[model samples]
Target chain A: MNSLDELTHELFTFFNGFSSWENSVIKTSELSVSEAHAIEILGTHGQMKMKTLAGHLGVTTGTTTVTVDRLEKKDYARRESVKEDRRIHLITLTQKGQQAFAEHHQYHSNLTEQILSVLSNEENEQLINLLKKINAEAF
Target chain B: MNSLDELTHELFTFFNGFSSWENSVIKTSELSVSEAHAIEILGTHGQMKMKTLAGHLGVTTGTTTVTVDRLEKKDYARRESVKEDRRIHLITLTQKGQQAFAEHHQYHSNLTEQILSVLSNEENEQLINLLKKINAEAF
Candidate 1:
C-alpha cells in the first residue's frame, strides 16, 4: 500500500487500540464486561426477551444465555417467562441489578468527566457533537 | 435529575455500550484484545523495554511479564537483554509476530471496508476525523 493508505491504517489501528484499552479498564468493574453490557441493555430497555437482548448485544442467543445465567447467579438479573409466549423468556434487572447498573453508569460518568476534563467547555461540546455524528454514521 | 441531564446520562451509557460491543467483536481475534493491543504498540514503536511496554499497556510490570511470556511462547515476540542496560529487557516482534500483526491489521481493514460499504464517502471521512478528534481528547 501507499504511504497515505498505511497512515490511515495505522490511525484506524490506534483508534481500535484505544477502544480495547478502554475495555480492559472496564473489565476491572465488579462484573465481567459482557455481563455489565447485558445489565446496561436490560436497564435501558426495561424487560426484554432473551432473543431480543442477544440481538441487541450482537452475540448469539447461546452466549446471551450464559451471560444471563451468570448475572442471575449473581442476583443481578431475573428471568420471567412471557405469559403470551411461553417460549420467550423475558429478562429484567432485579433491585440488586439496578444498583449495579447505577454504579456502572457512575463509572462511565467519571470516565467521561475525566476525558472531558482536559478539554475546554467548547471543545467538550464539539467532542460530544462529533461523537454523535460519528455514531449516527456508524449505525 | 432533569430530563436533559437524564438524556445526557443515557447518551453516555449508549456510547459506552457501543464501545463494549466493538471490543467484544475485536476480542474474537486469534489474540486476546490485550495481546492484540500490545502487538499494535510494538508494531508501531519497533522495540521497547518491558517497563515501557507495561506502562504503555497500563498494566503492572508483573502482569506485563506474564503477557510477554505468553506471546514469546507463542513465537509472536521475543525478549532480549539490553547490552548497555543489562537490567532492562527489550521486546521485539519476530517475523512470525509481524505476520500476526499484519493479519490483525487485515481484520481491521475488513471491518473498515464493511463499515464503508454502508456509509457514504463523506460520512466515512467524517467518521475517521471524528474518531481522531475523540482519541486526541480522550487520551
Candidate 2:
C-alpha cells in the first residue's frame, strides 16, 4: 500500500508537470499566463467590473487592478467608468485584445487536436468524463 | 460535430478551471506558486545547474535566474560554483528550504485527502487512468 504522503506527492508532481506542459505549449505572444487568463475571462463574459473580473480570476481586486493596468498599457484591455456609477469601472478588450484572444484560442485548439490525434473516440469520451468528475470534486 | 475552435475552447476552460482550483488548494509558507514549484523541483533533484533547473521548471533560464534570486534572498536556496567549471552555478535548497518543502508536501496531502473524500476507489482509479491517457497525448 502506498503511504498517503507518497500518493499525494505523486499527485502533486503530476499536477505540476501537467500545468507546466500546458503553460509551455500555450504561452505565445507577449501575454503572461495571468494576463492571458484575464483576456480569456473578458472575451467570454464581455465587459465586467474589475471586482467581478478579479473574482473570476481568483485574485484580489488589488492584483486585478495591477493586471488590468498592465493590460491597458499594452492596449489589450480598457477600463471604462460607468456613467451611472463612476466609482465602478468596467473592463473590456480592445480590438487588439480580441485578436490576441482569438490567437490564444487557436493555440488551445491546436493543443487539443494534438492530444485527440493520439486517443481513440472512446478514450476521448473517457477523458472528458474523468475531467468533469475531477473538477466536480475539486469544486 | 464540434468545430476545432469550440473543442479547444472547452478544453482550455476545463484546464484553466483545474489550474485555478489546484492553485487555491496548494498551501505554502511565504511562497508563491512559482516559488513553491521551484523549491519542489530542487527538493526532488538536489544541486542542479541553472540551465537544468530552468529546463525542469519549463521556463526560460532568465526566469529561473529571477526565481533563484528570490529563493536565495529568502535563505531557502543557495548557489555554488562548480569547481571544474567555475562559471557553472548549481542551486541547492537550504535546510529551511527542505522544511518548507515538507510543509508544502503536507498541504498537497491534505488537498488530496479532501478530494479523495468525495471519490470512490473506482472513481479514483478511473480519474488517474484518464489523466494518464490525456497526459500521454499532451506530449
Candidate 3:
C-alpha cells in the first residue's frame, strides 16, 4: 500500500477497534447503541427537548421518538412537560440511565488510560494536539 | 481537567467525530448502517460464511442472518453453497454491493485526506505512529 492507503488503513483499524470496544461495552449493558448514545448526551448536557436531542444525534425527530420510546419503556429515561408549555417535553435520564452513562464514561476513561499506557508522555501530547486540530477542522 | 481527563476528552471527541462521519456516509447510501457494514466486510475480505461475517461484525449469527436476508432482498449480496461443503454457504457481494463498498472506501479516503490537510507532515506521522501503538495495544 502507498502512504495514503497506509494511513487510511491504520486510521480505520483504530476506529474499528474503538467501535468494537464500544459496541461490546454497550452489549454488556441493557442498552442498545442508540439508547446508550442518548443517555450519554442527556447525562452530559443535562436535559433537552426532542428536537434538540434529534439535532445532537443527527437523526430525524421521528427516529429519535422511537429511541426515546424504548428508553421510556425500559425506565432509563423520561419525557417530562414544562410548566409553561405542556406540549414541550424535555428528555431526562433516570437514575438507572445515569448509572449507565457513568459506567460508559468510566469505560471511556479506562480505554483512554489503556491507550496512554502504550504511548510515551510526549506521544500522548502529540495525539491530543492532533485530535484537537482534526476535530476542529476535519469534520 | 487533569491530564488523564484531558486525554480522555480528546480521545472521545475524535472517536465521536469519526463515528458521525461514518454514519453520515452510510446514510447517503441506499444501505442501513448494518447493511453497509456487512457489505464493506464482504467486499474487503472477499466472500465468507455467515459465521465469519458475524465474527467480524461482533454480532450474533442470528443477527447476521437477518442482515444477509436484507442484503439478498436488496440484491446487493447473495449466499452461495460451496462445492466442498454443500451445507455451508458463503456470502458474496453482487456488483451493486461491490459498487457500494468502493464508494464507502472512497469516502474513507476522502475523510483521511481532509484530516491530513489540517496537520503538518510531521503531525501526520505522529498520528500514524500513535494510532499504530494504540490500535495494537489499547483495545
Top candidate, metric TM-score: 3
Q: Between candidates 1 and 3, which one is better according to lDDT? A: 3
The TM-score of chain B in candidate 2 is 0.77
Pairwise TM-score winner, candidates 1 and 3: 3
Instruction: Rate residue A54 of model 3 by lDDT.
Output: 97
Best model per DockQ? 3
Question: lDDT tens digits, residues A66-115, model 2?
Answer: 99999999999999988999899999999999998788767666777887
Candidates in descending DockQ order: 3, 2, 1
Which model, 1 or 2, shows the larger DockQ?
2
DockQ of 2: 0.42
Per-residue lDDT over A1-139 for candidate 3, one digit per residue giving the tens place of the 0 to 100 score: 8988889989999999988988888889878888999998998899999999999888899999999999999999999999998888999999988888888889989988888888888998898899888888888
Q: TM-score chain B for all models.
A: 0.77, 0.77, 0.96
lDDT of 1 by residue, A74-105 (tens): 99999999778789888999999999878776
Q: State which docking tier applies to candidate 2.
A: acceptable
Residue B27 displacement in candidate 3 (angstroms):
1.6
TM-score of candidate 3 to 2 decimals: 0.93
